[model samples]
Target: MADALSQFEHSIYIGSYMSGILYGINLVMYFLTLQGLLRKTNHNSPKSRRFFAIYSTILLLLITIDVAVNAVWGELMWIEGRNGPGGVPGFIATQTAAWYQTMGSTAVVIMIFMGDALLLYRLFVIYGSKYIVIAFPVLAYLAGLSLAIIELVIAGKPGGNFFHGKSINFGTPYYTITISLNIIITLLIVSRLLKLGKAVSRALGRDSAKMYTSVAAMLVESAAPYSAVGVMFLIPYAMGNPIAISFGQVWAKIACLAPQLIVLRVVTGRAWGREVITQAQSNVEFLSNGRPVVHASGIELQSHGTTTLGDAATEKWNSSTKSLGSS
Candidate 1:
């Protein structure tokens, strides 16, 4: 029985450690992408930027906290031992599980708050013309801030320690108000995009019309995939099975994160946009143009108002000139 229990712990620890490593890599990628975008206006959607900022900040904070948690789990409790690379430039293992888990739980709560903020921001951005732009962010701040206080203060050290372990339960509310709110928000986004699409499509012939239309289409297209995050996380939040639950939760986080990464990859470079086949085709054409040509009529290296002989002609000149000089 002891051996079986040890095996189970080992399996779970492996999953947790792998998840931690993946989380660290994801955070690094997000930070680099966010820094590059902030310096340049690569995207137009304010909601998107707001979400990126929120996501990047919260994820970074979580990465820090989890690094500590993984440390405690490995050295003190967990079976496999989290004794690999720290994944950061300089991270040392010192904190206790009590402290690490507490901080990590707090960070997780902050992320949920950010998710709510993002959903509401989407509404505000979509309805800015119809309503006050500041209202959404303001309301979001109030709601998230208040809930955050509840999570931080009322449920201190949420990782099965604080508030008689009420923190984890509340910290991870799945089928409750939070998840419902997310679903409703998703529906609202879909509805708003539908309305916005018609307006943008009206000016289809104009160059600018396509821009807004594309935005609307993209917003709509990405909505469903983004909502999948809610569904995945909410399950673990509500009735998490500890094993299957966390797997889904991590996947949800990745889903939320990957789209933004894809967007960053797309928006950053224009001339840098050619695929491998495209570049290969261009190179093929360029090299074929360099092939020998008898006629100099269609040449590109125009110099001194005269044509430079092609490869075939140059060869002929070398033979004739050499023979005459020898004579």
Candidate 2:
């Protein structure tokens, strides 16, 4: 039991250290994302900008509260409560259902939910808003949400422990379903982007297709790191390992970071939005002269005896190329 207590304390200490680093990184990224969204030169609609601004702000606040709560809990466990009852381990055991701990757990849940919701929204948009494609995912998300709620309720009860008894029973399945959802959605989004990239390549050249097919674009669009961290946490967690907490801490921060990265792309006019497919399919035309013409964002590209593109098209194309190149 002493050894176990030591392991738990070490796990929390390491997890907290990593969480702090991630939170700092997240803070920097949040500000950058916000700046991009609010830039006057950004072409996204005001409504879109406003929505993302609020979305990012809420995520920031939740993560801030989460980090702060964890810090307080750590102090209480290692210092204030260390000499009470049976020492630090006993204090932890007794306070498993404490309000601060519950709040931290709740913040993590909200972050996961928001991340999964964003993934679903991206999947919906990528598939051209076809509700049929997302029917099962939506059901799975709802089920996960229900389980999370139940698990939280169980953990918040008197003498409750998050990693034991009924709490673990519900928590295991809740995490399994939610993490599985992220993995499935990431694969789907990446598959769709790859397919579209192939078609764009054939029509508009590899350079143009790079915008959709690039590694960075796929990583951001699919939130691959978020899914990766979830898998890392879920595996050990399911096996009842103490180290799971460390991965879980990183997973929570990545949940926020992933969406912020996507939002940054969106605000910069580089993300694959709802109109990407439509624009790719409808914008390319073959003239009677056997020359290809491309239209994008109201700008025209004509391949005469010599290829010529309008200023707006050239600028947009150049910007995309630069973004991909830098990435």
Candidate 3:
């Protein structure tokens, strides 16, 4: 049993390290895509660029710091056991390392909070600021935050052991709340897109309607991975399994990359606007002077009209749900 437990811990450590590497790779992808967008096109205004830059940079920094903390703590607790605090002759069996509980868990919680908040903002924008639509998510967010604080306090207590003690109770439910929050937010966003797609389908045609559904699919593709990973993280831990951090450690990367992928897609002009249809789809031959034209019951819609940078920024930051293709 002891040997099995040791192997389980080892596996979790390896998994966490592997996930950290994946996070680094995704971070590079995000940077490269953002660079290409800014260099190749003027779709994002200066202010918009600044906002994205700040947001991306902060996430990168958080991941970097968290990974570093995990690396150092793993080395101290697992590797150079005789040279560290947990090395006091079988104390490792009795007491979990403090760093994983305090600093490591805190980093994980912070990343989860940021990711959820950003998704919440996106949902708010897409739903045309209907507070009622976001009421449940907002409540979940608050509850999650409160539980996270409780976890932090428990983990930070003098000589507290998060994984093997009563503190694990707080951590488990915290993960549950985070998972539930993400699921709720994801469903809300997807439902909105579906409704929008049906409306667009009625206005335009069957073919054009697929784009909106595609958007919904895109959202699910982005949002689902991290939530799934969060569930992976929670289940093992709740069952007193040692390999839970394998899933927990990598979710930060997924959460950060998902929204950036959407932004990158929109800026690249392959999605997010009707012009993509004019360029990519041949059947949407409704083009006037090389611009996509939309006819909704004989009402002409100019889908490619230029909006000022200020207008674009306003639409994004002010959370306006006005359709760019309509009027």
Candidate 4:
């Protein structure tokens, strides 16, 4: 019994420390990206700036709550003898512990959902603002959100862990929805970009199309890291590996960081590569007797023959619009 207790305690410590380190890294990256985004965003575009402002505010709030919850839970359950005196006999699921645990878990869930929503919105814009294209992803997202709320209720009711045993049933499908959503969105974006890049190469030259391919590659590369981390969390969790605890601790940090990096890359013009096109392709028009007429190729980006220049600051907006015809 003592040996088993020692192993369990050791696992908790390792997991806690790992989570702390990852959270620290997350803070650093978040701040850096926030600074870059603020600097590069067009001051004239109130809509874009306001959206980012709200995004950053919510992200900071969620992470702050997550960190605070973890600290309090650690202190109360681990250091302050909630697991019985001297931290032995493992966590005794009390009402207070349940609340703290549920709060932390919920915060992470909300943060991840926010990140996924941003990705879905990007997908909407990338696919020419077609609502029907994202209908399935939207349904899946709503289903996942409902499950997350259910899990929160369960966790708040004096559970040992939210992802254990019967709870695993809900948790499994929840993660599946999230993973599937991300994979579908990324795959669609990559496929479209590749197809467009090939077409551009044929029309222009290999050099011109290279930018499109590079941005596509960058998208895949940025998404791959956290997707792998999420899978690692899922596999160990399913198999009941103790290290799953460690992975779970770091999961939220990586979740928020993934999308932030993508936004930072695009907003900073890094996604555009070294090319400097002075004008937007969507800005191009043919003049007929002093009246502007839409260029045929640029018409794909329009919504009923109307285009807005205010969307230039966004990640998907810049990439999709510019790649279509920036010549």
Candidate 5:
């Protein structure tokens, strides 16, 4: 039992240790990217700053909690002479983790509900009709909270000397709730992106903007598969098959780390995107009398607009005015 426990213990340690390292990398990138975003945000505008505040708080708290509970707590739990209650099971370890666990509980509270609300806000960008009326961020909150509470209350209790290959088992359908939410949210976001893509295609008649959105959607889509995989990792742990689940975890690790980087990059690259937007091709045409007229290519951003620019420029100016080609 002890060896079986030690093996499980070591696997968990490995998983969390890897998770902590990735989280550290991601948190640093998030911070750097957010620093740039903060500089651009209108500090006085409540709406403009809300997302930054919320996601930032979550990332900060996640890092803190993960470090305190998973990393620090785990280390301390074993440090007190391995088979004994010396390290994390000791007073100092409990104190550090107890507070962070409480904070994590709070963070999860917001994430379960408010996070989904904030995510669905993007639906306004895609849907032209009443589809979003079905959205219930409040419901998401309630369901998520209920699931979290159920996990804590119903799961079995931890065994004696928590470090010596023994733990409390608390199995429930909590992850099912979480996974269902993932599918729901991913589908929502992808649907919105699709609609937004078509609208942008129709309005801007351009590819650059679409390329950006497509890349973003690709990044988002990449998440669902990986999330599905990562959540599976929890399943084995939750269901008492932890050893069978540990071998092929690279996907989960990459899934968790890569999305954060992609999101951070997009946030940082927003300025670059705007700069591209502002630099759309422009030209001035002249009447026979030499009066200047303004014309621009359709914002559609083809690598080469197959139509002749000279003729298109002349035609654009002509199309915009009552007097062009009249003289």
Candidate 6:
């Protein structure tokens, strides 16, 4: 029992430290993302800026509360309650159903929901807002949400424990469903991006395709790190390993961080947005004169039989080139 308690203590300490570091990184990303959204030079619609600003702010607040709760809980377990009753382990065990613990858990679960919802939204947009494409994912998301609610309720009961008893029955399935949803959405989004990348490449050039097909773009769009960490936590957690605690902490922070990164990409116009396909495909046209006419973002150019690309078309192409290169 002493050895087990020592391991739990070490695991939570490591998890807490890692969570703190992640929270710091999240703060930096949050500010940068917000700045990008609110920048005067950003040509995004007011609706887009408003939506991202609100969502990012909410995410920041939830993560901040989660981090603060964890700090207080750690202090109560290791510092103030160190010598009380059965010591640190006993204090932690007794506090599992405490309000602060529940608050932290609730914050993490909400963040997870937000992240998954964002992925589903991306999938919908990438697929041209087709309801059919997102039907199953939406169902899975609702199921996961139900399971998470049940798990939270169970954990808030008197003498409740997250890793033991009835909580595991719901918690395991919740994690499984949530992680599966993320994987499915990631695959769908990546496949769509790849297909579009090929079309764009054929129409423009490989450099232009980088906007959608680059490694960084795919990783951010797919929220791969969020799903990866979730898998890491789920495996160990299902195996009853104390190390699961550490991974869980990191996973919670990643839930917010991943979406923030995506928002950053969106605000900066590097993400795969609506109408990208149309924009790319409509850029090049072959005329009767056997010469290629260029169109960019609604600016159309006719080249008669000459090879000279007009100033307007050239400017638009250069702007697109800069955007692609930066992305």
| Root mean square deviation (Cα) for candidate 4 | 8.7
**Model 4 ranges with Cα > 4 A deviation:** 1-11, 40-44, 82-86, 95-97, 199-212, 215-217, 220-222, 271-327
Better of 3 and 6 by lDDT: 6
* Candidate 6, 1-327: lDDT as tens digits: 777677777878999999999999989998997888667777677777788889999999999999998889889988999899988877977997998889989999999999898899888878877899999999999999999999999999989988778998998999999999998998898887776665555454567468777878888999988888999999988877777888999999999999999888878877777656444445654556545554444343334332333456446644553242112
CA error at residue 206 for candidate 6, angstroms: 2.5
Candidate 2: clashing pairs of residues: none
RMSD to the true structure for each prediction, in A, is 17.9, 4.9, 8.1, 8.7, 10.8, 5.0
**Model 5 local distance difference test score:** 0.44
Residues 1-327, candidate 1: write the lDDT tens digits. 445445435544665765676676667677676775576544324565565566566656665565566556555543333443542111212222255555765665555555455446445544442356445445545654565566566444323333235645544543245555655566765665555444322212235334334654445333454456556655644553344334533543453354444434433421111121121122122224343222332222444322343455335432332221100
**Can you tell me which runs of candidate 3 are displaced by over 4 Å?**
1-4, 82-101, 199-212, 215-217, 220-222, 266-327
| Total colliding residue pairs, candidate 3 | 0
Model 6, poorest ten-residue lDDT window?
318-327
For model 2, how does the per-residue alpha-carbon lDDT over 133-169 read when each residue is reduced to its tens digit? 8999999999999999999999999999877779889
Residue-level lDDT tens digits of model 3 in 1-327: 676567566755877677677777768767775685467444555666666667667767766767777677666556567565546334455444464446666766776787788778767656665678778888888888998898788767766666657678887787788898887777776766665554444334556446446755556433767677778778887987767756656675676666565555444433334332221232222234544344321333444541112333323422222222110
Worst 10 residues of 5 by lDDT: 318-327
Q: Against the hidden reference, what TM-scores do the models get?
A: 0.52, 0.87, 0.73, 0.72, 0.60, 0.87
Q: All models: lDDT?
A: 0.45, 0.81, 0.60, 0.61, 0.44, 0.80
Candidate 3: C-alpha lDDT: 0.60
Clashes of 5: 9
